[model samples]
Each structure stands twice: as structure tokens, then as C-alpha cells.
Target: MVIPIHDKNPVSRAPVVTYGLIIANVVVFLLGPIAFAGPDPDAGRKARENAYLYHYGAIPSQLLGGAHGGHGAPVWPAFTAIFVHAGWIHLLGNMLFLYIFGNNVEDQFGRVHYLLFYIVGGALSTYAFAWANPTANAPLVGASGAIAAVLGAYAFLFPQARVTLLLPFLWFLPLRVPAWLVLGFWFVMQLPEFQQTIGVSSSSDVAYYAHVSGFVLGLVYAALVIGRGRGPDDPLRLRQKAESEGSGTPPLAPDYRSADPDDPYGQYHR
Candidate 1:
């Protein structure tokens, strides 16, 4: 599969924080088995490791209660699992997508709103997973669910934006594709997995349902919380619209005018 690297139309706000998140995920992954390994080394080791994930990861039984291995008590996994990844590749891959797409979404919602939206999307994703595979005891880890939400929001808000991806065929080559096409195809591809496994037990390890559900949740949440033409970090929507209506000219330059142009050496100016 091709790996995404960057996007054409990135958020105009602080992107440093987005990069910081990528760094954090990388560092955490490098810390190795100590942080993610299960409580027991043996005794259904894979299941136990995943159980720690289920206990700390998103589990539907914990959300809905008393149906199919549903945990009728409080679900703590929702919060912790957002930061916990299954492995280095898993962490790196998820963080890379987040690094590319999260800044714009965060800018749209502001840091606090974006963070809350991420957590909520993760919770919803867990709920969907638990609902889909109520009896499975496998551990679910990683930020894929939350990242899927970010992708959904990105796809909706910046459909025209382009993403730079590394396509590996004979060798690694970079290609730029529109965000709408990439994310839209991804969202569509997830649907069949959901349909095929609707009421059946998930024999496969991957929680495809959670990814699909989280993406939909992100789109819906973005539509509701971040309504049309109201991205906090994107003030160009109106200008773009005006340009389109008036002369079909390209949108005006982003408003980067300093509040006081005279302060040439101020940190803001710098």
C-alpha cells in the first residue's frame, strides 16, 4: 500500500503542534514493549495482550453492556486507547496520517475542540467495534479510529486539497492526488467490510468496522460541530466564494497581515 506523506493545502494555523504529536507517537513507539505489552507474558498471551488493549482499548461490551461479552461496568478503554498503538509500524502509520491531516482539523475546531472531537470519535469507534464484535476477546489498540475521524473531517473540509503519497511499485515514487479521491475511496472501501461482517463474529484480527464507523462519525461530527464555511483556522472560505462568484479569479492571499506592521522585529513579525 502507498504511504501518505504530506498534503497540498495544509492548515494555515500552527502546524508545529501537529508535528509534535507525530513525534510523541514515534517516541512512544520507540520506547518499545515496555509501554504496550500486556500484564502477563503467557496465558493466552496474544489474547491477554489484547485484553489489556480491550480493557484499555475500545471495547463495545464495555459501552453497551450485557449482550455479547459486554462489560456492564464503566468503560475506561475509550480514553487510554487513543494514545496506545499496537506496534511501531501501527503507531508510525497512524501518526503519519494524523500529522498530515490533523492540523487543519485542529485549526477548524481549535485545539480544545479538536482534541475533544478526537476523543469522542475514538469512543464512537470503540462503540461500533464492540457492537460489531461483541464476543471477540481480541485487544484493539492504535489511533486508527481517531485518525480515521480526522481523515473524514479533512475530506469534507478540504476536498480539493492534494495529498502527497509515496507509491511503491517498482520503487518508491511520490504522487499527488486530491484529498477527495483518496479519502473518498478509503471511506467507500470500508463499507464492504462492514456489510460482510454485520452480525457475524469477526474471525479476522483487524477491526475494520471501527475504522469505517469512526470515519462516518468524524464526517457527521464535522458537519454538525464545524458547520459549512466556519472553520476556525480557515477564513478563506468567504473570500474563495466571493472570488468564485464575482470574477472566477483565484481566492485572495490568506490574511497574514500583522496587527501592527510597524513592529518589524517583533516575534509575530519574525
Candidate 2:
């Protein structure tokens, strides 16, 4: 019920890569059987959908030792599957998350580094799922794995930022909360999914392994590589330290008083 709708964080640069990714997924979906019926006169809607998924989606069985039931090398699907989705709900959910969190992370890392991080994180996530469910025949699709990376990066870089959430029961009212609280809760909720049998894919409908692995990879990479081990942003603080030897009063903090318009703390700064 704690659905995130938006973040109070703002970015300095345009997120071309994020926008491009969304567009690409939309285009692919529109071209697929889900939106436009395929050219196969003999195939039914379900058959065409299955054919598309089998060809583009990543199958853990193929990724492991099983014979390739898909076209081309198995590696191709590992990457291509990032754009594929099982249904309209799947596509929209992933795209919504990416649009919400990707801007700030893209700005923090710059387009190039962020792009590489997203792609690699997604690819690795697929492999992580495949490793855990080596014998499972389900073909993994959708951009959840990549979007999870963006969520991790956003949580790291803007922990103090406020996220607006809309509860399904209270659809008319929006609640604003800290980024850390929201993202931390999200990561924690995924932990229990690990208890599902590792090699048994039928235990869960969602790819929890990929979701967790992608999140960890994004967070670790952001900390160690991109952010250089930097910790989360501290909240705005109030202090009465001596300003100068000559100045009698501790001089009211300039930044603390006059907040930047984009500051997440509203009227304060650290």
C-alpha cells in the first residue's frame, strides 16, 4: 500500500538515458503482440505472445546447462530481456519507478557512467536469478532489475530527500516521507523472499532474487566506485559555534537561515 509517486529531490541535468530507456520499452511493447497482433495468421494471441517471450526473454534453464530453447546465443536474451515485459502491468510498474528515481541518480553519476551502471546491474541481476534458479523454465522479462538499481542509487545519494507516497486506500491524499525510510523499508521487505527455495522458481511469481541482487549491486557500486565511499547526506543542523574572534554574537548561520530553493530540508541547510 506504500506506493511511491514522486521524490522531492531535483536534478541539475536532463536525464536523457532514463527517458530513452522508457521510450525504448514503450516502443518494444507497442511493436509486440500485446499491443499489435503479429503477422502470423495461423498463431493465436497467446501463441504469439509465448513465441515473443520465448525468443526475447531470458530463461534460467537456457542460461544454465539446459539446451537452448530460444533463438541465438543465450547471452543475447540475458540483455534483451531487460526491455521485454510479460504484461502491461509489468511494463508500466517498472517504467513508473524508473521515471520517479532515475533523474537524480543520472545527474549524480553523469549520463555515461549511469548508463553503464544500469545496463550492467540489470544483466548481472538476470545472471543472479539464473544462478539461483538454474533449472527453472520461466523466461525473465521486464525492467524491474534495472529500475531497482536506480532506486538503490537514489537512496544512497539523497537519503534526506522527501518521497511522496499515495496509499491505495487514501488515493486522494499524498504523504511525504524521507527517502531512507521508504527505500530501506523496500529493501527489508525483499529479504523474506530469499527464504523461498533457491532452485525452485515456482515458489514465487516475482523475481525476488534479481530484485535483491540488483539493489545490492547498485548500492555497493554507488558507494565504493561512484560516490567514493561517501555516506548519506546529513540533515540540516543547528549549531552556535563562534563565527569570528571580533564578532561578538555567533552570527546566525547564513545557509541555515537562507535555504536554497532546491534544498530537501525546506528552510534549512547543514
Candidate 3:
């Protein structure tokens, strides 16, 4: 399994929005049901947990023009669900990804645009899942869909950047892989599950289509924002230049080399 630990890419600006999002997610998860589950806490927490899921988590049926099913605050759940996670593992995993890839994406589009992109991507993902499973009753929660969007944007923007992956079977050996290879593979991997989940009329715990849809939205957003854009950092133009240099033949993807004097890691061309 390819587990991303970090990226070699550095940001030109401090990612305030990314940091805020991580903190917000942590705070919400701590306050949410996942953190309080002891026997003493369980009795009262169960009701709160149910309430949290119903009130904040996006129920597919409700989003797709179905009854509220007693879940209050149905309209706001689309945005709130982005911060709600089921467990510590879920919260931490999503936060880690956001932490890893968000900074650069935030740097790419400034703070405000990045924040807008994140929120919109999340809402779109939730809606996509809702469309896919209109009759299901499960309430989908977590930041995976949003984070997947970040991953998608990162994949297109820095396709050549090296992502450090922890390979556990090899004694937790660290392997640096290309972002395109990892993220592209990840997007492809989601297709089978997305296809399977598209027509089924059952309550699935995970909204795989949401993740897929969010990633696609991110890709489209990035393409529109970065394509034909005249900048060395723009991936689409760079790819086009590379292709042109190859006389229409596909050339080997080049690694993104850092040129910033402040970049402590210097330039990595592989």
C-alpha cells in the first residue's frame, strides 16, 4: 500500500487556511462523539453521537429530495459534514492528507480561493454521493471528500513532485514516489468502487463516490485555473511545453525542481 507521509514540495507562503482547517477538524472531532466513548461517557454520548450524525452529517436521501427522517438541520449538513469524522483514525487520516497536500494548493491559489475551492469541492462531493445513493439512509461524514479534492489539485499542479511513502512491509522503509503516479493511481483505484456504488440501494458506511467526485471537481477546477496560464509553476503549460519539445512524442515526465533560495531542501530534479 502507498501511504503518503510527506511531500518534497515547499510553499511560497504560509498556509494559514490549511492550518486553520486542520485545527478546526481536530477541535470538532475532539468535541464530537469519537473522543468520548468510555462506559460512563457512552450512555450520554450515544445520544449525542446520534444527534451529531443526524444533525451535521449529510444524509444522501435528504440531500436528494427525500424526507428529513427526523434529522434536524438538514440543509446545513452539507457544509458541516466536511468537518465531522466518525473516529480518531478517520479524523487523523484526513487531517494528515490535508496537512501534507493542502499547503501547496493553498499557496497556488492564495488563502481565500483555496478556502472557497475546499468548501465548494466538499459540497459537490456530498451532492455527488447523494445523487448516487438517493434512497440510502446513512449519514456521510468526514473530510475525505474535501481532502481528495486537494489531492486531485495537487496531482495536477505538482504531478512531478516527490511524495514520501511509508512502506510498512519493508520494515517501514520510506519510498519517495512521484505525485502523479501516486495520485493518478489513487484516482483510478476509486473508479471500481464508484461504479459499484452508483446504482446500489443500500447504506454504505463510506461514500466512495463523494471522494471520486470531489477529485474530479478539483481536477476540473485546477485545469481551468492553471491551463494556458503563463507561469513556470503552472503544470499544464509545463506539460504542453514538454510535449512540444518532444515533437508530439510523449516525453518522460520531469520532476519539479525547486528554485527558491529559502527552500532548505534545495532543488530535487528526480
Candidate 4:
């Protein structure tokens, strides 16, 4: 899995929405496990503890009425699940990717538009997964689908932009690669996995279809939304002008430290 570490182009606007999303996801995960605490310590221990996720988790079967389970109270799991995570690794991974890619996309869409894009992207992704596996009975959760949208937007808006990645071959080594090369490669890789899961009989525990669908939607949405802006030559022209005038590689990575002085999460870095 090629994870993005940094973007080649920095955003001109604030990343309040991005950081807020990170905080929201973290808070939901913390509350989910505790809120859904079960009664029997052994019999339904796992089920009770994960009640919040199981009931609210995006289950294709439940959406299609092929299965039954999920919270009846509040009835907001569909949207809430986006913030809930199964574990620390899941939470951290999603937050990290969001922090890395979200800012630039936010810059492109502006805060309000970016927020809308994220929610709609996630909702679309969930619908895609439900459509693909309507009969499967499994709870789907995670911000991956939404984050995939951001990556898709990043791919289109800044294809020439570079990303700093840690290539794990023998040792952990950091290398810079063009965004198109990394994200495009990732977008292509999802197709095969999506195809393989097409006719499976068993319910897929993982929502792979959601990721693929969200990515495609993101690409289409970005093309329609951000594509109208300055042509592809604009960024290159600006970069060239900056370089000729003795500026460092185009402002790809934002100075997060200064962007949010009291960044409560403490994850933002320069």
C-alpha cells in the first residue's frame, strides 16, 4: 500500500475543515466503544461492546433488508459510522491520510465546499457499496471511502505535484514521487480487487467496493467542480515563474504549525 506522506502543492486557504474532521473521527471512536458497552461480559461481550458500530455500521444486507441489526435509537449510524473506527490503527491511518491530502483539496474547494464534498463523497461511497453487495450481511465502517475521494481530487487537481512517501523495501526510506504516479497507480490497483469480489457468495467484511466507488465519484466530481478553474498550464506557469525568480520547489507542503496555532490534535507539522 503506497500511503501519501506530503503533497507537492500547498493550499492557499485555511485547513480548519480538515483538522475538524480529524478531531470528529477521533471523538466518535472513543465514544462508540464505551456507549455500546454490553450487558453480559462473556455471552455477548464483543457484540455489546461494539453495539454502536454493529448497529450503525453500514451493512449492505441491512440496507437491503436481507439482514437485521444496528441501533434503533437516534438512528444516525449511517452518517455516524463515518467517524467511528474499529481500532487505533484504523483511526490513525485514516486521520493521517486525511491530514496529508485534505488541505490542498480544501484549498481548491474552499472550506464549505470541501466539507460538502467530503460528506457527499462518503454518502456516495456507502451507496455504491450497498448497491454492489446488497445481499451481503456485514457492517461497513471507516473514513477510507471519503479519504479516497480526497485522493482522487488531489490526483486530478495536482497530477504533477510530488508526494513524499516511505518506501519499505529493506529499510524505511522516504522518497518523493509525482502525485499522478502514486495516486493514479493506486486508483488502477483497486479495479482488480473490485472485480474479484463481484460474484462472491459470502458477505465481504471489508467494504472494498466503497473505496472504488468513492474514488470514481471523487474523480468525476472534481473534474466537474475544480476542472473549470485555471487550466492545467496555470499551475505549471506559476511554478516556472516562481522557480525563475529563485523560489524553492512550488509550495506543495503547507506549514501546518502556523496554519493552526492551537491545533488541539497536535498532529499538524511544518
Candidate 5:
């Protein structure tokens, strides 16, 4: 298995939208019934979880018609499903991707646009999943689809940026590689899963269709709509400016630092 550690790219702004999205997902997961703080069942922990997931999850049948699983899935659950994670591992995995890749995209699109893109991309992806499995009854949950969009945008906009990945095959060795290669590998990995609409015959709960659709949509949208946003306040300029202010480098880059100062992603020299 491969796990992304961090990226070399830095953002021009504070990425409050990314931070806010993370906070919102975490809050939803904690407050939701799938967190096990729900109405305690006499038994069947798994049953309660299944019930909870299907209740709030975006069921293809409900979204597309011919409802199954006793009752219909939540009304228009695409938006709600993005905030609901089925388990701790699910929550952490999605959040990790979001945290690692989301900031730069948010910076590129600014807060509002990025947030709208995220929500719309996620909803569209969920619908794509539903379209494939029109008869499926299982509910789809988690923010993977939206995070996949962030990955797509990041890959397209910062193809040369370095991303450090932890490779479990090599005993968790850290491998630093270009963003395109990392994202390309991710795309290739999702290919087989893409053959199936999520929740059809798959025992696993992963929404691979959503991931594929969101990634493609985000990539296309990044190219057509955002297109890197490398004007006056580009990432390179911010990095250079940040370095010059702190390091001994000459102050040749434009100043784009926010009025409030504390930046955790310290000055990048190279």
C-alpha cells in the first residue's frame, strides 16, 4: 500500500476553506451515528453501522429510482454523504488526502470557488456512482470523492511539484517523486475499481466510481476554469518572498503574505 506523506508545494493564502472543510467533515463524523455514540443496539454493532450508513448514505436506487433496502436512502444524500464516514480508518484516510492536497487547490481557486468546486465535484461524483449502480441499495459515504477532486486539481496545476509517499511495500520507506507520477499511479490504481459502480457486487464500501468521476471533473475544471492562477500571487512568488523575508536571499519576489503572520509551512529555498 502507498500513503502520501506531504507535498513540496506551498499555498499563497492560509487556506481557511480547506481547514474549514476538514473541520466540518470531522465534526460530522463525530456527531453521526456511525461513530457508535448513537442509539446503542442490544447487539449487532455491524448491523447498527450498516443501518446508519444506508440511512444517510446516497443510495443509487433512491437517487435514480426503484428504492431498495426496505426504506429509501436519504433524500438527495449526495451532499450529506460526503460528510459521513463509515469508520475511523475511512475518516482518517480521506482526511489525510484532503489535508495533504487540498491547500494548494484552495489557494489556486481562492476559498469560495474552491469550496463550491469541492461540493459540486463531490455531488457529481456521487451521482456518477449512482448512475452506474441504479439498482444498488447500499449507501455511499465519506469525502474520498471530493478529496479525489483536490488530487486531480493538484496534479494538473502542480505537475512538477514533489510529493513524498510512504511505501509499505518497501517497509514504509519515504519516496519523494513528482506530483504527476504520484497522481498517475493513483489513477492507474483506480482503473480496476472503476470497472464497477460502487455497491453493485463489491463487498468493499469504497466508491471507486466517485473517485474516478471527481478526479476527471476536477482535472477538466482546473484546466478550463482555474488554470493554475499563477498571476501576481503565484506559489513560486510566495515561496520566494517567504524565503527572502526569513532567509538571506534577496527580496526579489512579490509580497503576498497575509496580514496575519504565523505560517507553519516555513520558507522554501529550492
Candidate 6:
């Protein structure tokens, strides 16, 4: 297993939307265990958890307009599911990915677009899972699908950026690998599960298709945006005024560019 710990990339601006998302997810998770406080705290916590999931988490059958579980309209759950988590590990893992990758993506698109991208990516993920298993009655929850979109964007937008990963194969030693290798390997690993789920031959409870779909969605989204010349405020162009006036070359390196630019080989520097 390889766990991503950090990255060496820097963003052009503060990721306000990314921080808001992390906080929102954490707050929602904390509210779950105490939502139904009663005579028995433990039992209440457990009951509240179940209630939270059933009422707010997206159920495949329900999302597909089936009668399974007979939950009401799926709109709220489709949006809320991204904020709901199964446990601390699930919450932390998703948040870590969001914290690490989301900033750069947000930095590229600005706060509003980034927020919209996240919500739309999550909604699309839920729909993908529902399409993959329209008969499934299980409630799907977590920010994994959404964060998978962020990873997808990172894979495309910052493929050469270095990320530190702790691999169990190397006795948990850290390895600084390029973003493409890490995210690409992860997307490839999900293929087997995605195929199994499509073939209706897997027993895994995890939603692999959602992860795959979100990734693809994010990849396409980023590709379209970047193709249309939308990118982090062009650092080079922004300094053109000073450079044109011969202000000592603006004090920054030309190679310090966005992940994808007209020149793909330009190396990103600190």
C-alpha cells in the first residue's frame, strides 16, 4: 500500500475553498456521532450514525429512481453524501487528499469554480455509482469520490509535480515520486474493481466505479478548462509589466509555471 503524505508543489493563492471543504467534512462527521443523543450514549451514537447514512447518504437504488429503501428525493443525499464519512480513517484519508491536492486545483480555477467543480464532481460520482449498480440498496457515502476528482485534476494539471508517498513495500519509507506515477497507479488499480462491479461479480462494499468516474470527469474538466486558456493567473504574464520596464527581470524564474502550459517540458521550481 502506498499512502500519499505530502507534495512539493506551491499554489499561486490561498485555497480558501479547499480549507472550507475540509472543515465542512470534519464538522459533519463530528455531528453524526452525537446527532441522536439519548439515554444510552453509545447506542444513541450508533443509531444516529445509521440514521444519518440512511437519510443523507446516497442509496444507489434510490438515486436511480427505484423503490429500494423507499427514501425520498435523492437530491439532498446526492449532495450531502460527500460530507458524510464512515469513520475517522475514512474522514482523515479523504481530508488528507483534499488538503494536499485541492489547493493547486483551486488555485488554478479560483475559489468559486473550484467549489462548483467539487460539488459537481461529487454529484457525478454518485450518479456513476448508481449507474453501475442501479439495484444496489447500500447507502454510498464519503468524500472519496469527490477527492478522487481532485486527484484526477492533479494528475492532469500537475503530472510532473513530486509527491511524497510512504510505501509499505519499502517498510514504510518515504519516496518522492511524480504525481503522474502515484495517481496513475491508483486509477489503474481501481480498474479491476470497476470491471468487477460492472460485471456484477464483486462482493466488495467499496464504490470503485465512483472513484473511477470522478477521476475521468475531473480529467476531462481540467482538460477543457486548460484548453480554453483558463489557468492559474499566468505568473509570467502578470509580471510582464515590471519586466517590460526592465525591473531586474521581476525577481522570479521563468520555469516557475503552471503544471501544463504551452511548453510542457518547462520544469516547475520553488
- TM of each candidate vs. truth: 0.74, 0.78, 0.80, 0.76, 0.78, 0.79
Candidate 1 lDDT, tens digit per residue, 1-270?
567776655344786556666776677555545355555455555655555555555555545564333333446666666677776567777887887788878876788778778877887797778888776655676788888998998877777666667767847777667778888867765665554655534436567788889998898877776776475344556656655788443333332222223632222221
Q: lDDT by residue for model 5 over 36-64, one digit each (tens)?
A: 64455455776767777877788887887
Whole-model lDDT per candidate:
0.67, 0.74, 0.78, 0.71, 0.76, 0.78
Q: For candidate 5, what is the TM-score? A: 0.78
List residue ranges in candidate 3 displaced over 4 A: 38-43, 66-73, 193-203, 231-270
TM-score of 3: 0.80
Misplaced by over 4 Å in model 6 are 34-45, 66-72, 193-203, 231-270
Q: Tens-digit lDDT track for model 3 on 42-116?
A: 566788877878778888888778566665556677888999998877888888889888998998778998999
Clashing pairs in 5: none
Please count the clashing residue pairs in each candidate, in the order shown: 5, 0, 0, 6, 0, 0
Which of 4 and 5 is the better model by TM-score? 5
Please give the TM-score that candidate 2 achieves against the real structure.
Answer: 0.78
- Residue 18 displacement in candidate 4 (angstroms): 0.3
Model 6: ten consecutive residues of lowest lDDT: 261-270
Output the better candidate (3/6) by TM-score.
Answer: 3
Candidate that beats the other on TM-score, 1 or 2, i.e. the better one: 2
